[model samples]
Target: MSTAIVALCFSGPTLADDVSPELVAFARTQAAHIAARTDVIEHIIAQNTNHAHLTLEEISRLDVHWRQQYGSQDSPLIHRLMNTPLSDALRSLQLRSSELITEIIIMDNRGLNVAQSSVTSDYWQGDEAKWQQTFLLGPGAEHVGELGRDESTGSIQIQVSRTVTDHNGHPIGAVTVGVAPLQF
Candidate 1:
């Protein structure tokens, strides 16, 4: 973790026509800010490199395990991800937003979670549009997911995802921020 301060902005075209401009702007600002953090970038890079050799079968296994242990207190994998400093930072960011942000998930190149504000339903997001439309799309790419109700919080929110690029401007990962439009 070099903690290098980089100035980055979301330069992609908005992908969701139904999402309001204000919500999109808010999401983009949060995504760009997170993308510019060296700690986040480094963590994603390290995780991506570490899991680069995992086969699809291995990924599915992990995903299945994660789903089985989603809300379990004894889940080793979920416990590891939720207790990290990066997860704490994400939680703090969500709290400080005064309910505008509901959740945040940082994903590696392969769509495995590097950090998250809270426990997600599943582990592998590689098959989801959030990752496919962003990390797989290239640098500056964004995907605004459809509006949905958050089960835990009972709030209507939209997931905004953007490609997280390294200092050299290469796509290394993706970040999805859950935003509640009504919070604005």
Candidate 2:
């Protein structure tokens, strides 16, 4: 009984129970920086503005369509999007971040993927807690998602999401950046 109590006390909090304050701060600061980038801001604004009238359901369905099409290796849309200069720019940014950033996913207001550094498990983020919390709460909102190991990168990462607001401070979408805990 005493040993059990001691073990429990020593175990402390799990990553799921709480994210370190330093990592949270790093995420917030990085998210703000990403939001302030001129090109990134412009891209988000343009995507959101173009699809401003889309309802939540419509946006989710669009995500499904994109995901289904991209699943095929010979997908024309994926090839075109992934081979463009824009993709090169995104990949460059990810490389510049070193190992700290494992992945980057930018979503439109409807939670549809606008751009991604790598392919994600899904396209629609509306159903995900990270997207829901940040998007619904608008700008200044942040969500620290689950901690897990990336099989491909073999890095322990936590998904951090923040609202992507426009010039007028209106949230146009959200961006989730994966931070490797060991690097940070």
Candidate 3:
């Protein structure tokens, strides 16, 4: 009988220039959990299916309203979406792994948000690095965004994204997860 051991590693924060082998290993392990969770992935896909029929006009209208109401202030969309069953469902799903997750955002194929765990700065994420990497790169590609500080919590985090795909492996949407590095 034989057993295999897997090792994990992570580079420290950009400014610190300190690399903790243990934290690196922890991050790698937590990253696995983030990537391999079927339930989380499925929730995102289910949301994509729910909004698959959305027209550009509808998204545009919401975007316009969001911008007008929130402008540079804290986004009110979170509260708006939270009132809906869709966001409620997502919030419930997120609660299952709240310890490891900082934020969750589900976006349609067009990069417009279908639902989110919290209010974001905008309704569209198409131009962001995370969306481009996950949605544009097609399925099987995971986008690991650069580590940054969460303005609200002031905690360092790394954003990760994966393309949402249909049973036939066609790209449908994308899901982004903000993870606190220390938790890993």
Candidate 4:
């Protein structure tokens, strides 16, 4: 019984274990999916010194690791980030390539939704899967969750994210992208 108790205590991750196989697999699959497409959203994150690809801290969370932060209502980034409608973005991706990227949400350090590809109009970006990994519980490597759903799809959506950084490599935010694994 004492051994059982010890096993239970050691069962879950304690911020030292290497990232789970599931997470690593999801990350690889997401990168591959995005890489397979060119006209659609590119996995490429670098543009210039001012513009950059998302960072490991930004793109690491997926379905299981709940996000944990949100942007301030008084911030201008909230306005600029959320400016793009989810419908428009989804439509563009859908029209551009045969590849699939069903939803995309901008998550802050706290995991709140700054912007999304669809739904989430009123900012539901706090302590959810996409935002939580970077801010909470682990050795601080990238994470990926298995397929899951939101209020709308009722289908499996693969979540992907990386830490967003500035030109000086300062951590700024996170970006989460979701794609339907198997459309029903």
Which candidate gets the maximum lDDT versus the true structure?
A: 1
Q: Pick the candidate with the highest TM-score.
A: 1
Model 1 clashing-pair count: 0
Clash counts for all predictions: 0, 0, 3, 34
List model 4 lDDT by residue over 45-115, tens digit each: 22222234445454344211222223234544334444554435544654453445565555444444444
lDDT tens digits by residue: candidate 3, 73-181 = 5646646665666566556655665455667777777788767766666677777876898879987766766566754335466666777776567777777777664
What are the runs in model 4 whose C-alpha is more than 4 Å off?
1-91, 94-99, 135-140
lDDT of 2 by residue, 101-124 (tens): 887777778777677777665667
Each candidate: what lDDT?
0.84, 0.71, 0.61, 0.43
Name the better of 1 and 4 by TM-score.
Answer: 1
TM-score of each: 0.87, 0.77, 0.63, 0.47
lDDT assessment of candidate 4:
0.43
Q: Which ranges of candidate 2 are over 4 A from the true structure?
A: 1-19, 53-61, 69-71, 83-86, 150-155
Write down the worst ten-residue block by lDDT for model 2: 4-13
Ranking by lDDT: 1, 2, 3, 4
Ranking by TM-score: 1, 2, 3, 4
**What is the overall TM-score of model 3 with all chains considered together?**
0.63
Candidates 1 and 2 compared by lDDT, better number:
1
